[model samples]
Target: MTLYKIDEVASECNLTKRTIRYYEEIGLLSPQRSEGNTRLYTREDIERLKKIISARDVLGFSLQELHRYIEVVEMLTGQRERYRSITDLEERRRQLEEIDDTLGKQLDMMESKMRTIQSFKEEAEQLRQQVREGMERLGRQSVERAEAEH
Candidate 1:
């Protein structure tokens, strides 16, 4: 149940204080506030920030995409909560089946996105290697020309 101040959160998450505040503004975070109006971050906030960083920096998902994903997550969470209130065994089983199907599709969609991002990374690496080879060749040619001139 430990809480962190904004500074602590920024340091722990490797983000600027402004960036953390901006995330709150954009609905990516919802830190509680002290009586003095200072932002108070819980352990859940820290974990969520890590996820956000990975989603943005590693997966290359834009803020809008993150927002949309959050919406889908919240919707799914609500659906799961509804199962707790269901009393009839048959109805619960039906709801559970629906949840399983939806979860599978969501996982598939995430896998597809990861594959696409990996493709882009591979392409960039190949381009980088080609550029490096070209630069090395040019440097060698320049040196050869200089020796010949001498």
Candidate 2:
């Protein structure tokens, strides 16, 4: 198993060392520790950090929301792993239902954020249209004034 120190992980993940530490502090990450108490990260840890960054920067998730999102994702991951081992049809069906429910929660969060972003985009478009109209009105008034002077 390959392990990396914090600096390597931070550089690879495009995050600062402090940010990685903060993520660990906030329960967003849990890297292993070395014999001297230094943080050691695995490839999985780097992937998780990337997910966190995407949720934060792309999805505009608040820390609280990100936490919940990560929780659901982790739960779903575990459920998927457990699903492969079970042979009972009823148990597999139940596991599938749980996975579906977990997926629904993630979808809900994304849909809520999308709705908020869509509203903001609409407001911006409205403002842009208003400004365009105002500019055209002013241009017409200036033209009329010039024509009167001529």
Candidate 3:
């Protein structure tokens, strides 16, 4: 049950203290408070912040999207816990369905981001192709001018 201060947590997570506080302000994190109203972070809180960082920086999720992603992940975690405790066949089936639904939401968000990245790549390739064509055209005109001069 190790507790960490905000500075320690930020350094461990490679984030600024203000960024960590901002995440808390946006409901993405909720570290416990100390007796003096200072924010105290647990190992779990640090882990959650790492996930938030990954979602925002690696996955390029906007704040709104990150909120939804965290909500789905939390729901799935709870559903998994409930699933292990349930014994009835119907209840287990329902739990599985809920888990699947949560997973689908996450997958949808990832797919949308992938599509956007792919679109950007395609546009970049088109621009590169146009540049290549323009260069080739210029080279041909240069040769033609030299020939005409000669």
Candidate 4:
């Protein structure tokens, strides 16, 4: 049971201490405590923080979104464990298949969300270009008007 202090976790993960604390405040992380009440993080906590960071940085997920994603993943994993423990062969097979299908659907939805994010970026870029072009045209119009008035 290797445990790391808050500072070590922050340094190893390249995260600010404040950010790690904020994740704890937001119910995203739960680290154990030392006998002296100091924050002691296990490997699981470190991994979870890294997972959250990856979701945020690589996938561009908002904090709320990442929190919900973690919750859903944990719930599904728990459900998987329960289904795997069933003794009856037929029932176990049915439950396992259902869980598998649900997981597949969840993955499909995430892929769709990624595609939507890409589309949003493209739309924003296009609108930015339009705004820039409009501003240039307005500037030219203003110059012409000033020259005529002179």
Q: Which candidate has the top score in TM-score?
A: 2
Q: Candidate 3, residues 44-140: lDDT per residue as tens digits?
A: 8998888888999988999999999899888888999999999999999999998998899899999999899899999999999999999999999
Structure candidate 1, residue pairs in collision: none
Mark the 10 consecutive residues where model 4 has the least summed lDDT: 101-110
The lDDT of model 2 is 0.95
Error of 2 at 138 (Å): 0.8
Q: Which regions of candidate 4 are displaced past 4 Å?
A: 101-105, 124-150
Candidate 1: where are CA atoms >4 Å away?
81-87, 118-150
The residue pairs that clash in candidate 2, if any, are none
The order by descending lDDT is 2, 3, 4, 1
lDDT of 1 by residue, 1-150 (tens): 899999999999899999999999999999999999999999988988887898778656789877766655666777799888999999999889878876875677578788998899999999999999999999999999999999
For model 3, the superposed segments whose C-alpha errors exceed 4 Å read none
Give the TM-score (vs. native) of candidate 3: 0.94
Give me the candidate number with maximum lDDT. 2
TM-scores, one per candidate: 0.65, 0.97, 0.94, 0.72
Per-model lDDT: 0.86, 0.95, 0.93, 0.87
User: In every candidate, how many clashes are there?
Assistant: 0, 0, 0, 0
Model 4 agreement with the true structure over 90-146: per-residue lDDT tens digits? 998888887787787667757877998989999999999999999999999999999
lDDT of 2 by residue, 1-150 (tens): 899999899889888999999999999999999889999999999999999999999999999999998998899899999999999999999999999998999999999999999999999999999999999999999999999999
Provide the lDDT at 20 for model 1. 94
Between candidates 3 and 4, the one scoring higher on lDDT is 3
